[model samples]
Target chain A: MEFTSETTANGVSELSFTVDDIPGVLWSPADATGNHPLVLLAHGGGQHKRAPGLVARAHRYVTACGFAVAAIDAPGHGDRPRTEQDEQFTAGIRARLSAGEPIGPQVATHNAALAAKAVPEWQATLDALQKAGHAGGPVGFWGLSLGTGIGVPLAAAEPRITAAVLGLAAAETLAEAAARVTVPVEFLLQWDDELVPRDSCLALFDAFASPEKTLHANPGRHLGVPAFELASSERFFTRHLGEGVTQPR
Target chain B: MEFTSETTANGVSELSFTVDDIPGVLWSPADATGNHPLVLLAHGGGQHKRAPGLVARAHRYVTACGFAVAAIDAPGHGDRPRTEQDEQFTAGIRARLSAGEPIGPQVATHNAALAAKAVPEWQATLDALQKAGHAGGPVGFWGLSLGTGIGVPLAAAEPRITAAVLGLAAAETLAEAAARVTVPVEFLLQWDDELVPRDSCLALFDAFASPEKTLHANPGRHLGVPAFELASSERFFTRHLGEGVTQPR
Candidate 1:
């Protein structure tokens, strides 16, 4: 994997790289003199590395909390070309949604496959950033929907991450993932999410082995996640990754 | 893959082979002087090739319908070694079932992966059997639950299979698979299945593109699948596969 780094005039640098052809972006405080805390951001399903939600969250964590944020497009999303499996999945989703059929099972099936592919990509990216001296401090995580589906499992397997924000998904295939994760977590749930079952979502949260966790359930649909939740997540990160000096003098 | 063949006292020749280290059993009527129809059977999750349901069904097909039947242990069953993914899947199932949580999502996730692995194995077995002269006639399929999950997709992808029996499972990830299947189908649904949602099962049955298909829904639990359903499946296979002169005398 190779990265192209660009520093903007506003003291923020954007680094683009590919791991096993998975496109990813990393945002960092360009003016930082040394290593900084890293927050690996995972985007929801059907989204990309630079998704607006992730971009806004990344920037907030960088400028507000002094962290380097990284995100990669999940398989078959963003700039990556669609494979045969992706086409099958997209066609199935479209057809099922049109018929008003339940899509939860199909999503879990595909997400499990994507999660297997994504976890190592995040690990590889973290390794690359550490070697470049741009990251390698306390690591935290934030993800929603598809992001949560993939991020929870990835974070569970990786010990570097100490905190997480997971939202908007159920535990069908994620129970095992949540059980393995012992990191502090702030889990958000959209109570009226049409595509996700409330009981399943709560079960995933309940399965978390984390010693410290808080559940934030808001009254909204899947897309109607309240914007205020972002602030709540930022504060969670601040308390975890921002307590120490992000950079050594 | 190596094979050990034994001609039993009942005049049934059993060929046990390992494909990619996956164990399988082939049952053929030794009295048949020539080629006969071949039916591939897939057992459910956590069950192996020697599963009582699959074995009894295979024997009836061989003796009653004179069809050569074959079944293989799914990736983690029988003699095949359990992979790390398989271990994760087993742990997930155990945790969910123990907690009284829905195992559907976990089932779909692991089945999808196992399905992906099992499909090529079936094709490979067919290719090997054809070369060995033990198979290569009208091809049909039979599987329920985990079997249906893997069998439906396998039958859909293999045009040589002229008929299939799939049921006792949901349509979550099977819509695309059922769409690709145009062969005759005998779908069996066990009503009141504690684990599989009924709506999802019917939806899958409705998604089948096959012009010749029958849905037989019985009132019973998942494990309480009526013993008579086997008789119904037998008639369906016989109607589809028994009419042709499967042997070249």
Candidate 2:
């Protein structure tokens, strides 16, 4: 199914779009009228729509707030075509690295090309949202983990996005990304989290360019955030997306 | 190759322990004196020691502050024995869940048992530390992600641990774990992180059994704790470990 439409408990309209050409899904509230701000939500590595609790919650918030939400599944994940060959390729690269062999320039270039191949699809989705009349003045993006890696470049490449929330991601360091981002952003950090180091995030945050930025730390493990803070996320999205656009019913 | 030791530039001892009987490496800092406190550091799922920068930083902090640190690699990761069969098993389980197929009770039980198997080994590690002539008074724990998962039970089972710093973990629902944790605890939260919900963390904090609880929020993503707060971690270990240890050189 390329897209599906449904109604929420509050009698609002909702849509879930599945890109046949890609391996991901996009969701939006039906009540998001023309010129409504669009929020594109990105998932973490090795996860799909259901992995992060925040996505669903964010959906609910944006829906109530009159903003459209789009949740995307990255390449090699979800319903996207994946093969043992791709896995083997990654494995081979990993093996070489583990054996203390430097990656040949060809291998690195091939990987980069593959990554570049996925960008247009993501950008196309953003364009589609704008064309659908759901995008307000500028788009907003929220990415986690690998999503952050992709989102950073996307945001930088497309000036159409006016604001972003890059949680656990950076272009160089958290500080560098922070400095590069001209939009309002909120960075989240875990004090004792072991998956992503504290230093990386701090360095990124230090590099943020916006004075409107803020850093929030909460207790919970990696892959455990959505279950930890549903209300706060609602508040954050609502604040950024605008008033009365999202409110818990 | 069972264990390797190095003195850091700052004069702290970095030690890695390998147990042939187990699948992973256990890294820590050699105690300055035999009488220093001991802390067990656990990592989250699908991550090695380097993934969570806080683990090593915490180890360094505790060691510099005159405590011993032990970091363990969990099952299915970090120099652990893993085979295609194990990957298949994990994939099968995930596939079944994704397809909405009912999981057999046997499979569930088997998986649960595998997780439970680590408990004794963790306990025995503490015992080994004690036998090594380290001062056993006021043992503590620090964990993020999977580490948080294991630390909860470990803290409950091991009465010797006096304090803990838990980031990005839910012992149970925040409500259940908070009620159960009788010791002083500090929780870290990232407000916009998607992997774990922020609400759950807040709920857990509210449920703490002791009054000596603190919540610190920072900005970043699901990658474990942020980097800028190494000093805070040092202070935390120092306050709990008791005085007389020197700060990092």
Candidate 3:
């Protein structure tokens, strides 16, 4: 499937890209001009681009901050149609798990393979943006929750990504893809957060090879953070993206 | 329903409280002695006592650390049976939004009403723990993600709760609850966390009226925090529980 862009009356351009060669939407600012910094926003597990609060917020911030943003729904989410092949793959895993068979390693391997296959689709979207005359040098990849699982690997694989932001996520192992991110990386974590263990997050941070990294801790729970901290994110992005804005202390 | 208790081989007793007024599970540890503090663990949205990762970690910590722990699944999550009444309460709001109707105030009012109704169920669990001799006087609450939403309000409503550890949660306005919490409150936040905005968490911390609060920042995302920071939680709980155990820095 080919990618396309449509301009909405609200001055937002909805760019459609392919996932496993299937169509998906990527919302961007239509009014953006010059060599604006680019951001590719990825949603988390069981969520579409619109469902993940961070993706929507990133779109708003990047657009408002004079940068172009492309928010994509992953292969199984949003407008991307699921094929019978995908269903069979998942069903096979479920069947194995239900039969009292140990499927953990198999599932992990399958996910890694799937992630590897999905990289070309992500790179294609970036190439499309470059072809659209919005090539703003290296793009910034922002991943939320499950998106982090995919984004970390993709960013490491694609050196075209200059910087990356990971929210509410941790590298499952210290030796995994997150440690491989050589570009400037920023990690955000919640302290009393029970959803993800804090030890895993700290371990991932300690494992990162990136010299340009910062960790910020604030007070709020999973969904509560973004609903409450738009300004802080705006400031963080501004500083990191070199937009020259700082939030008050 | 009545509450029940059974002693396990590991010298830890499991106390279960059945709520006839609501469908919920109250799991508490019955091993409180010599100033060993109690921890009340609350799970996130659409979750129950046995939710993977977070709940499991809480149980491990409570058992290993010699702290009494009480955990309850909220109204719509876990073993609790969902009712048509509950369905309508949330479905109505979604329907309204889907129909392009403005229902902001109505949703807020409904949430407030539902929270008011739900508070008693949690209070009942607390009362049952006290009655069963599972909880010590200086009880602390640890809420993960959506659990933090419930914990913040519960801590404010119940004066018996001596301390609180809220992970990844914040209200649009933090003053009312922050002012009401008389005990030490710890707010944990993540930087670059796409799950929750960091500013909202900071606002929540700033809103606290009590001076006995600490904020810890770590590297990682929402799920990453809990996955990585179990040790930090133990340290925080121990510091506030004050049972004289030296924590690992």
Best by DockQ: 3
Query: Lowest-lDDT window of 10 residues in candidate 1 chain A?
Result: A240-249
Cα RMSD for candidate 2? 21.3
Clashing pairs in 1: none
Look at candidate 3 and tell me the lDDT of residue A225. 47
DockQ of 3: 0.14
Q: Write the per-residue lDDT of candidate 3 for residues B1-249, one digit (tens) a residue.
A: 465555443445555567655443333344345445778787765567766765566555556566767676677667676778668866886898799875534533444444565667778877776775555557788875566667767888888787887756554634466667767776676644554556666566666655466565545566556333465566567766765212222
TM-score of chain A of each: 0.94, 0.74, 0.75
Model 3: share of real contacts kept: 0.25
- Candidate 2 structure quality by residue, lDDT tens digits, B71-186: 66666657777667558766876898899865443232333343465566677766655665543556778776566666666666677877878766432333454577777666
Interface RMSD, all candidates in order, equals 20.1, 4.7, 4.0
Off by over 4 Å in 3: A1-5, A52-55, A81-113, A192-195, A217-224, A244-249, B1-249
| Candidate numbers sorted by DockQ from highest down | 3, 2, 1
Local error of candidate 2 at residue B80 (angstroms): 64
Residues A211-237 of candidate 1: C-alpha lDDT, one tens digit per residue? 666566555578877665676677778
By lDDT, is 1 or 3 better? 1
Instruction: Please tell me which model should have the higher TM-score, number 2 or number 3.
Output: 3
Q: Candidate 2 at residue B198, lDDT?
A: 61
What would the TM-score be for candidate 3 when compared with the true structure? 0.46
